[model samples]
Target: MTDKKTALVISAHAADFVWRAGGAIALHQELGYDVTVACLSFGERGESAKLWKQDGMTIERVKEARREEAQAAADALGVRDIRFLDLGDYPLRLDREAQDRVVDIIREVQPKWMMSHSKWDPYNTDHMNTTQFALECRMIAQAWGHNPGQKVLGAPQMYLFEPHQTEQMGWKPDTFLDITPVWEKKKAAIHCMQGQEHLWEFYTNVARNRANHFRRNSGGMAGGRKAEYAEGFESIFPQTVDELA
Candidate 1:
């Protein structure tokens, strides 16, 4: 296949991409990759506590606010396209229609690699549900018969971004991405999620902790490169390579 550097991120909620993989998106864009982010929901009902606390705040109003915030975050991350599916959240469910929509996006982008939530998340079922939706959509996107005459997707690696609580979610990171150069961009994206201010500090610390892991894995005290910030991912499929490093 010709190298047309492209990537896709399936975020369960509007701010999910920013917190989990903003740095990865920014770094990849710098490396000449066109990154697309698809947020399934605005997270207005479930994730927007601050906005809900407002007097007589409607779900539409909350969703509008979240959309604006997500757009700002996408700009900060240098995303090529940010698609908001606007499916309802809280009890995020993907029926046939929604699943087909996701499949359409996967086939349209035909990304070299994709990113989404971990396999499980008890704290928030939506997170896990979205991952399942991503997997199913990916499978459908690869089938030629799904929609004759349309482009089918190639087998692209799917990386699961770190969940909010790794231990609880059973997410183990096997890949560490050093995103020091784009740390500021990620930070700016993080700030855009003003509705969830508490997560700002939380995700920053997660990046710092991942940097420590990157240092150890890249090379210990022997000569590990210093990374101020990083992101962690768990690959769903084994990578194929001609030679092992």
Candidate 2:
């Protein structure tokens, strides 16, 4: 077992982690956790509209650009590891082989916790599908019978990061994390995604708004902790604790 804590974030697209969980990633890294981000695809076919709009852009070129952007963002966030699965997107193909590959990653990381997209994303099936894939991979990692000799994974809380259009997606955030200390790190990472310039400010505003929720929930005006930025998440599993606060 490693001395340091670890975590894993399974992002559906190259930029998904930047938009949704950059704050969490940076904050965790700052707190001495080895955070690994696995991007299932570069979102080449479906999400690269601006790159595709360019006259001479080929699929390979778009993928290269997106991969660069993701790498830059990961660097900005101080990520310990960033893996690109290169699985084709626009309806991400998570075949049996893909599932086994992800299971291998899950066992390798042995994350204290895991993060992924919401359970429902009608606007983008890729996001929701990624969450389902995460669940399946987590299960496989825990099955000793499947991979005889490898270390069987322990129960790790799987956190679902906030998806776009929260209201429409039926994603209720049960956890609000104050990320004030690392907000700048997250902003820097967000800016690294030059391919999606429009979303830079959008996610910044999301952090600010989530901070408000954090404050209100922490304790209203009477005792709320002062926070400038935060992120929201929904846990897929019940947490076990010795005592309730």
Candidate 3:
């Protein structure tokens, strides 16, 4: 477990943090990282059908419920803060102003690492746009002239978390984090999304499959251990020491 690092995950929708990178988020928190989640929207229009199906569930009510759910998940993982940009859900469009706002958050947080949805997720337009926006913010934060009221922090290590359907989405797992110890925590966090309970088993299976892939490749004694879970990440840049130095 790496100690006392800061991690930020920017997601296109509130539930995305749970569905995609919950394991990684839990592991970071368990390792004493000051984790934060920035959700672009509550996913009211797209992902909240279950919530809205309840009698008299207004859009505002759905959003409020989702916000509470997200916060609970973050708290369960020991996250320090959660921010929601409240942009419109579904077909997310990253306009100039939205990009600037994201960039400002990056500069303010100065995270050691940033995680977001993969840009190539074909099933979700919002996911792709969020990825593009996050990448743009990363570049802007590190650029020479753009100032967002804070010292220009160097670019944080950027990682793309696996999309919901990895193989279909062309999400190859280039890096895997052994999140075995925090698997339960991850599950608990995901359980906070009451609206998504039906999909829990499928996602759990996905994590197990990723763990097996890492075990086969890494070839360590711990690799043979069963009941392990993993999270996959694709680095936006080479993880060379010079890059960080």
Candidate 4:
């Protein structure tokens, strides 16, 4: 791996990182790589089910709670740079300006690897839209005239993460990352999302199952490792020797 390489995970909601790629973030940080999280929404709508059931749980209150949760999770993984785009929840809309903003962030961060939700997810409208925007922004950011600030950045490798309902959502995992050493850290990160405990549990199991799949593929190394966990991803661009080496 390259020194000072950065991994940027852009999500539709603040807590999406916890469910999708928390272990990957921890592993990157553990290996001395720079990791950043960019959230398009605070997840004010979808995550408020628990709090809304309680007394006085307004949308603003839910947003604040999610902010705190995301902060704590990021802190646990030693991540300092976190950005929330404040896009609407449920159905995330990315207009021209919103796309430009994403490009600008990519220009500034200049990450080597960028991860976002899979566009093929059928269940969540927000996830699919955000994924499409992220992919388009990545392309625009890499282009010469489209993003002037992106000059310093090499073309980034983009990966789409599995959604919560991978099988039901039709998310096919083409690549699996080993997160065995950072599984504990990933769990700790996930614990920060108090608003979505029920939802997070499902993802935790998904990670374990994906780890098992990797284990089987790796000739049982994944299963043999007790604390193993994995994140699945699908790549849009084919990785070349120059990108990896």
Candidate 5:
């Protein structure tokens, strides 16, 4: 077994990781954590409006384009591994096989932590469905009886990354990560998602706004350190610590 710590991120679509967790991925890499991103689908049908508008665009071609874009983004973020399950999207669904595949990855990575979508997303049903699937897979991964010889998963904290529209999605962030050091890397990763060019600035603004929240939460308005970029997350389970930091 490797000595390096690992992290896993299960994304509903190819570009979702870039938009939501690119900073975290890059920062974790700098901290010597091997971060792996698993994209359930290429988001060809639902998230690729620009490519769809082009002439002679087939589903396979769209998937290919999205794969390239996702790879570029993952490279920019310094991800250790990025894979597409290609299970299909627009209404991303997972069967027993897909769940098993996720469990395999969980056992393989043995991640110290995991990240996924919010529990509920009104704007995109696929996002919530993907989170549910991840949760279920995590559960399955922890069962020793399912696969006799396979390594069982530990109780890793699963963080729910901020959704596109937090207010409507009912996502309340309990953790704020300062990504000021890795903002440029995150921006580069975001730019790689050419299919969703409109989101580049939108997520940048989201990070900047989250920075303000981080400052307020970390200290106070008067004594808070000025953070330039940040990411917000909601933990699905309570964190256990030996001592209060």
Candidate 6:
């Protein structure tokens, strides 16, 4: 699909985008796509265990802390436009108001493609809910009756980024992106998530393993390209191609 070279990422929590889709965001930004990240919540309740552990830390303080971390990560990934929905997490209040706000953003950006969490995640309902919410908003953005006059969105492929436990989440990646060129940028973004420092090394290893998959899928060891880092994505829609190579 073609548009004004724009993309959007719907993240359930503040750091979800950085952990799962950071490489894609950095690589696409270098390729000249204006990628915007919409964080549905600060993850203050569930994801910010470290920050919450601090003495005398209130929910508001935890939210602010995670917001700063998210902003820093966004900056590291060269994302100039990052929006925080500030919806309460642990159970996101995805009411009609939230859906309308997201629908507006989808129409405004008119992204060529979108990124979100896996379709199913029993471990974190927030992640899975965000994906459904994204699908709903995407559908609404394309409807002529939803909001009269706005440019309807095209059928952009929605990509689900890798989850923490892929096996349990039913996340099967069909696409592997060689993110070696922007791996440093992604690393920096990952590091910016101080609230989740324990995941830094884990995701770094995930990238390396995916890079190996990239080579294996591209070609055998005999003819594969040597990629040091990569990211995986599961496409939710069938790709429309003129020819199958």
lDDT of 6 by residue, 130-204 (tens): 999999999999999987888888898999999999989888999999999999999999999999999999999
Give the distance in Å from residue 143's predicted Cα in candidate 2 to where it truly belongs.
0.3
Query: What are the lDDT scores of the predictions, listed in order?
Result: 0.94, 0.94, 0.83, 0.82, 0.93, 0.94
Best-first order by TM-score: 2, 1, 6, 5, 3, 4
lDDT of 3 by residue, 62-156 (tens): 88999999989888777878998898787776788888888888777778999998878778889988888888788888876886456675757
TM-score of each: 0.98, 0.98, 0.91, 0.90, 0.98, 0.98
In model 3, which runs have C-alpha deviations exceeding 4 angstroms? Answer: 1-4, 220-227, 241-245
Clashes of each: 0, 0, 0, 0, 0, 0
* Clash pairs for candidate 2: none
Of the pair 2 and 6, which is ahead by lDDT? 6
The ten-residue window of minimal lDDT in model 5 covers 217-226
Residues 1-245, model 2: lDDT tens digits: 56769999999999999989999999999899999999999999988898888998999999999999999999999996999999999889999999999999999999999999999999999999999999999999999898899988999999999998999998999999999999888899999887788888889999999999999999979999999999999998998889998
Off by over 4 Å in 6: 1-3
Over 1-245, each residue of candidate 4 has an lDDT whose tens digit, in order, gives 33667878998999888788888888889888788899999888875688778896788888888889999999887787898888878877788988988888887778989999887767778888888888888878778877454464577888888877666776777888888788888888888888788766787788888888777766665344443578888887876775642
Q: Write the per-residue lDDT of candidate 1 for residues 123-143, one digit (tens) a residue.
A: 999999999889899999999
